[model samples]
Each structure stands twice: as structure tokens, then as C-alpha cells.
Target: MITRYDSNNRYSKAVVAGGFVFLAGLTAEDCSLGIEEQTASVLKQIDDYLERAGSSKEKMVSVNIWLTSMSYAGGMNKVWESWVAPGIVPARATVESKLATPDTLIEIMVQAII
Candidate 1:
């Protein structure tokens, strides 16, 4: 069975299937936020959804991150490196893209098993 949450007109923010959770792409709410703040906000959102699905970041198997500018990769990596689960880090990829919102600097999606 599959469960979806935060449904609306546009998209479901998260979904759970079998023993895994898939989080939708998420970006910072405020455009002026820096990479660190944006990363923190995204992670927090992920945590909330994971908790609801009976999982956590440590259980993540994969993660995909998108950035509006590649130039911020270094700074973003710094925060990501610190937030990731120690010793059981998930496979991750970071890419540059023009986000859906003009002010968005970064967006993240995650897949995890409970």
C-alpha cells in the first residue's frame, strides 16, 4: 500500500510505499536565505515527513539535490556534509538547474527505507 501526504493542487510533498519514503523536491521559502539556512530548512522538512512515515534521515538510501547556481556548490556541500547521517550516509547527487521558483537557490529530494 502507498500513502501520500500534504496533497494539494500541485503535488504531494511525500509518499510512503512498502518500507520506504520518497520526499518531493523542496526549496527554501525565503529567497534571501543563504545555502546553509536553505539546506537546514529543507532538512527540517524532510525530518518532519520522515517522522510521520516512521523513518529518519539515517535510513535514507539516496538523495538528489538541485541548485540554482553551481557556484554555491561548495557552500552547500559544507552544510550537507554536516547534516548527513554519520557512517550511514546515503548515495547523493547534486546538480545545477533553474528551479521552479525564481528565488529558490536549492531544492532536495530524498528516498529512504524505514
Candidate 2:
């Protein structure tokens, strides 16, 4: 069975299926922030979503991060390293991509055990 939460017309923010929770790519609400702040905001959203899905960052199995520019990666990583579940780092990938908005610096998608 599949369960979804935080839905809008476009998509559900998170879905639970096959013993896993899948989170849609999320961006900071305040896009004017720099990479570090944006990254932190997105990660905080991930934590909330995971908890509502009966999971946590430590249960995350994979993460995909997109940045508007690779130059922002270092700043992004610094916040990620501090926020992520220690010793339970999930499989992750970071890449430079054009985001949906000019002010959006980063977007993050994650999958975790439920």
C-alpha cells in the first residue's frame, strides 16, 4: 500500500510505499538566503517530513541534491554535514542544475525507510 502526505495540485510532498518514504525535491521558502541558509532550511523540512512519515534522517537511504551552481556546493555541504544523521550518512549525489527559480539555490530530494 502507498500513503501520501502534504499534497497540492502539483504533487504530494512525501509518499510512503514499499517500506520507504520518498520526499519530493524541496526548496527553501525564503529563496533570497545564501547557500548555507537555504540548505539548512531544506534539510529542516526533510526532517519534518520524515518524522511525519514515521522515519528520521538516520533512516534515509538516499539523497539527491541539486545546486544552481557548483560553486555553492561547499557551502551547501557544510550545512548538510552538520545537519545529517551522524554515522548514518545516506547515499547522496550533488549536481549543478538550473532550478525552477532564479533565487532558488538548492533543492533536495530524499528516500528513507519508514
Query: Which candidate wins on TM-score?
Result: 2
In model 2, what are the clashing residue pairs, if there are any? Answer: none
Please give the CA lDDT of all the candidate structures.
Answer: 0.89, 0.95
Q: Tell me how many clashing residue pairs each candidate has.
A: 0, 0
lDDT of 1 by residue, 46-95 (tens): 88999998999989999999999999899888988788778989999999
Q: Mind giving the per-residue lDDT tens digits that candidate 2 earns over 8-71?
A: 9999999999999999999998999999999999999999999999999999999999999999
| Cα error, candidate 1, residue 66 (Å) | 0.4
TM-score of each: 0.94, 0.97
The collision pairs in model 1 are none
